[model samples]
Target: MKNIILTLALLIPFSGFAQEFPNLKSTRQDEDYSFLKNDTINKNWYKTMKFLPINESKSAYFSFGGDIRFQYFYAKNENWGNGDQDKDGYVLSRYLFHSDLHVGKYFRAFVQLQSSVVGGRIDPSPVDANPLEVHQAFADFNFINEKSKKLILRAGRQELSYGSQRLVALRDGPNNRQSFDGLKLMTGKENMSADFFFTHYVAARDGIFDDKSNQDRQFWGSYFVLNKVPLLKNIDVYYLGYKRAKANFDDATGKEIRHSMGTRIWGKSGNWRYDGEAVYQFGDVAEKNISAWTTSINGGYRFNSIKFHPEIGFKTELIRGDKTKDDSKLQTFNPLFPRGAYFGLASVIGPSNLIDIHPSISFEITKNIDWIIDYDMFWRYSGNDGIYAPNTSLIYPGNTTTKKKIGNQLETEIVWEPNPFLYFRLEATWFQAKDYIKASGMGKNIFFTGITTQIRF
Candidate 1:
């Protein structure tokens, strides 16, 4: 039955002619590419929405943009727990407004304001709620602009993300995106660059002007990207440091300081592509030595000659776990600021102290429509630790059981882009529990469904 379902999914996209869709890429392209990168509005979308039109004047050096989104989610047996309230539904709405101003050839300013709200019967978590706040505000100054070299300095509240977004990201899947209060410096040209930053995460509050940089935590990092590496598409290397005044975990709680260093290499040739990353961490938590690591690898192939331009890929990852409760050192890996949807649409699990194998396939139904299907299997790397949720919350403790096998998940998603300014998506997922969850009194099949729509102007 699974084979039949996958066969049909691979064929659905070839049923009709290819269509064109608007590009929805992020606004963080390299500065050397072009200053008008964000101002290049799509001509196929509504054009009359421009009010000031400074974007149309070559000398004006100012631009404005915004986005609106609506999302709804339904879940059955959330966290594999049994209860009437475990099955729930919720809806979220978000609005973002931003502006950019440039002065002469070296200075620029940017600001973004956002509002997010929740509706429906489900309990609202921190990710789903935040009303009216400054999402980002920053100033940029260029130190060099030669053909072969470039340097930039930026300061104030901003967004930060590194390679692959497995360990660091802006949290785009949630209603309220994440931000940081920081200073950053970038060096190098278009083909190679390095970023150095010092910052603290901005905590989202439910009220205006109440959002503040987390005083108890500090972060610093340097990331390098090499666009042209031999035998590969590119390479990434980074080092990050994190300190928290007080931290908590299954076996301990106290001040913590952690350092992480990692490298990633990825590339594509012909019809095949691949990505691999590994990281090691060391620190002190609760006066105990901390040591942990993680490794991930993913590869895929595209069938261009097939009807739908289908692609299939497999991913495997292993994260370290604490050796024993009596040990003085902690071993669970910590993904500091990972993407919101790191593990597919359901996002029920995090990359911490566990092992996972994921197989996925995607189809380009048309230029405007796409479909994706994923299956994942989970197991505890150390049966003595616990299972952590995508939010880094401890959902099941080690004392709950010594079982290793956790569960399996299946998910499907469809995305539609009618024009450059609008997009829609629908997704559904199911999870089947194994002995581990059942032993913890949280045994049950889980289901999740959601729909989202967004418009840019």
Candidate 2:
């Protein structure tokens, strides 16, 4: 424990002087600090550590950085009081350190180490603990590097996040983030970009360095994005393929193979912003024809003239569900890999076989502080199908109950950023059980409160 404390101390910044530093990316691998290569502009206290020219060559260099995050959750009536609940709460701590080495721009190497821990919990899941492990280790080779266009090939283990992260994500909100072992080819220009990737997701383990890729599960996808569309500011199109040897759903458990095609359009004009996405899926589940789909649209209007500059937003989603468990065709939508906070910080529910309407409002209380509140109402798309967890696993069985109303939730969060290197957040959630929850299982309301502190250097 002492060693862990000592390591986290390194992530604290003595001064908030990172304003001029390279902007941090969601996945650190995409960050570029090459501009610091020039000696004339490299005159910051931390510049020396950020950019280290190898033997004065300047062409080849090294950069080092990391972050420390600690989160605590106090959940009441977990799973609507159906599951075990800790009396007090649980704590999740994560540490990440990385090094980037550039070999003459054409070739580059990156490595990251991770340690996540969970404490005071009734049951610890695999993702809640991984004492220590290699989070990401990858190499990149640039096939074409030019002013107008560029292409790069990357291999080994890495984190993949794209679009709105409804389908594929890094699981950033979880204690132990997800990583994939595979290869990716990326090509892009000023107005367009695309990625082709093939990989197997690594399974999380509680033990140290025991994580490995799941051989029975494979994922491959191609994603394309076009910027500055005529009516829309941006457009994204993607095709994803997934295969799992043994998959379990609300109905029978068996092998599954699925393909998804999706399109997204997003843009902002004046004080109005909109984001819309639609997806269609087709495949085979135990040799049975599979068909499912989902559509989501969100719009927000910023009240710039109002106090605190509040932005009112509304979002709606409809995810297909199987009409019956013993049906000839499976219609349950699969959310491949999605964020943990699909609904709110409680995140008890997932995006499958359901419909949700969310209305929210956010305020910029100050230059460094923000607050948001949202309400979501959920209903099962098909009463014959059950509700799922954030990981797309069945949680509440249909039990032949035909009730459609599941529940409603109210959530609020506040974030404070004193500087560029540190931030603190607080969140609370309440979910009210409805007819379905009462008839199927525990009908208790779920309450959750969370506090998080993150430090980056």
Candidate number of the best TM-score: 2
Tens-place lDDT per residue, model 2, 1-457, is: 4444664476456445756753776588878878887766547657777788896669888898887888889989998888777889988998899999998859999999999988897887766788999999999998887767889999999998888999998787888888999999999998999999999988888788898999988999999999988988999999999999887788757899999999999999999999999999999889678899999999999999988999999999999988767867889899998887778768888999999999999999998899999999999999888999877789888774788899999999999987667778999999999999888788899999998888776
Model 1 quality (TM-score):
0.89
Return the clash pairs for model 1, or none.
none
Give the CA lDDT, 0 to 100, for residue 36 in model 1: 36
Top-lDDT candidate index: 2
Candidate 1 ranges with C-alpha deviation above 4 Å: 1-24, 28-60, 82-88, 146-148
Give me the displacement of residue 178 in model 2, in angstroms: 0.4
TM-score for each of the candidates = 0.89, 0.96
Return the lDDT, model 2, position 232. 87
